[model samples]
Target: MTSRDTLAPVFRDVRAVVFDTDGVITDSARVHAAAWKTAFDAHLRAHPPRDPRLRRPFDVRDDYLRHVDGKSRLDGAAAFLRARGLDTPEETVRAVAADKERLFTERLRAHGVDAYPGTVRLVRTLRRAGIPRAAASASRHAGELLARAGVLDLFDVLVDGGEAARLGLPGKPRPDLFLEAARRLGVPAPRAAVVEDALAGVEAGRRGGFALVIGVDRTGVPDTRQRLLRHGADIVVCDLGELVVRGEPK
Candidate 1:
């Protein structure tokens, strides 16, 4: 390893790497955003009396990036609804979110989600390095996405929306999911690495006290990478391919 590699906390006590799905592994954020838009738009049309006051459907790309990209299903719904002046109860919103998930899954089955070779290569590198790996996501579709991406068996642990709700794990900015990931990997919180693309997720990593938090700037937009750092990421890169996880940087 080079000096830069030696300087990385992931090179020290890191026997594991925990990754976030959606923006991190696959290019399915667009797919999810589209599904969310469809569900929300239809729900609004069907229930005009609900608190939502929007004239048009939520924008899948921009709206999702702002409110729902890496958040839990119900949390995402609550956010968008609130944006439209709705204050539906958390539990009630959760039910709506579940319905939205059903729709999103249908879309996934039809179109399929694809993973980045760079991300798969990174996970493979960690596995070859004898380091455990896990996948964390606030989306309930994490399993389907990973399986469709053909990297389901790469992870020894999965802490996602379904599992989080089932286990009462806290969502982003609370760190429960990331913490559980480290525990499942048999790595102490301070010895594991976290890779995410959401501000909430980066905050989760910092709150969990992970060794390092690497943020992905997938949009290639200005200040997007910097926003991740401001949210508490230790390092931010445009892609996973930019970092050397198991060996010297190419």
Candidate 2:
């Protein structure tokens, strides 16, 4: 191993790396949040909350991270609705999720997302080091997102939401998706490292008994980093580049 790898010793034992697709690999989390906000705001307007505080609009940062990030559309919708004290009937949750999905799809097709340079660099470095890589996400559009960002070829395996659904795998905070990705890469959870931007994603990694859980906190908020740690992240970084060796070439 290189001297740089010694400094970040976690990589030495990691045989495979599983990455979360949205904020961790691509810049599409914000788009998802915006779409969620629009759908939720409309829902709230249509059916006003009884409590004044609950009437407040959805916060992309707080609400998204706490309730929706790393979760499936239906789960996310249900979580956020429950947080706001809204009725969470299955049909109601499905309706809101469908609306958010429509909005997100429209925005995505109109304006494609880009992969983070830092993440790409780290991925390439891992590849050069002969470590397998996987991209896993709760979004059904994960494959399209990666393809649009031109980085779909970087991963050795992709366990997207569609596959998860077909296989009856549960979403993040449950560890099924990441475990599946690692399994496809022929690596056990104990030998794989998981990189994630969502609280639930990191928790899943920890629960799955992964070798390392690196949290990406793009929010730039100190509390966000703390929250990630609290949620089971072994390490928290502002960007994936921080984990990259200084002299390593992309």
Candidate 3:
């Protein structure tokens, strides 16, 4: 039960914690990015842009981080298309989004995502410490993903895309979903900590007035850690393992 001295300074007063799903808890961000690349590349190939500069395929890193990550399916589709200078009609956007959804679902079912061991360790520690935890995500497949990864039971509450739609909550960067999750845990926003990997999610947590915003940088991508800071992450860690309790094995 010995807590990490580094984390003690930040999480000591935290009453609850909310986590973002994809890159934060599970290794599903790459799956989603791959699906987006497939769908966007297909669309671009079929309708070659008039400008040669826009002829390149989707970038799983730059494009994903800037436009799609932490966004709703339709929003992500529209954002990426808009970035390519395409003002497509509603049907076209929906079609592209649907294609991505299908591809992601197929990959997820075929090759399920696994929970990050560091995240799992922290979750277990939180549970033992009597801290309530909630997992919130913009993906409709969040529940299925968590169940598949065998981490569904780790959370005291889950506020995912399906639930967001039912409640008509606004997507990330707006703070609705995270707020709802904190509410369900019976914790005030200012007393809860938010853990996220995406820029939008970090911004949302900041906007939600959470006590602490933890940014997770799995790979230390170029400027990613800095971007997270710019988006309002109070602290940044390359791995949740950095926050593990002192008595725990690294």
- The model with the greatest lDDT is 2
Clashing pairs in 3: none
Candidate 2: segments with Cα more than 4 A from true spot: 1-7, 248-250
Give the per-residue lDDT of model 3 (tens digit) for 26-130.
999999999999999999999887888988999998889888999999989999898888877999999999999999999998999999998998888888878
Q: Model 1, residue 116: displacement in angstroms?
A: 0.9
Model 1 per-residue lDDT tens digits across residues 35-149:
7888788767766644334656788656776777678887788888777766679776877787877877788888898888778777776776688999999887799899998
The lDDT of each candidate is: 0.80, 0.93, 0.92
Which structure among the candidates has the greatest TM-score?
2
Per-residue lDDT of model 2, residues 95-188, tens digit only: 9999999999999999999999989989988987889999999999999999999999999999999999999998889999999999999999
lDDT accuracy of residue 15 in candidate 1: 72
TM-score for candidate 2: 0.96
In candidate 1, how many Å is residue 142 off?
A: 1.7
Instruction: Between candidates 1 and 3, name the one with more favorable lDDT.
Output: 3
Q: Ten consecutive residues with minimal summed lDDT in candidate 3?
A: 1-10
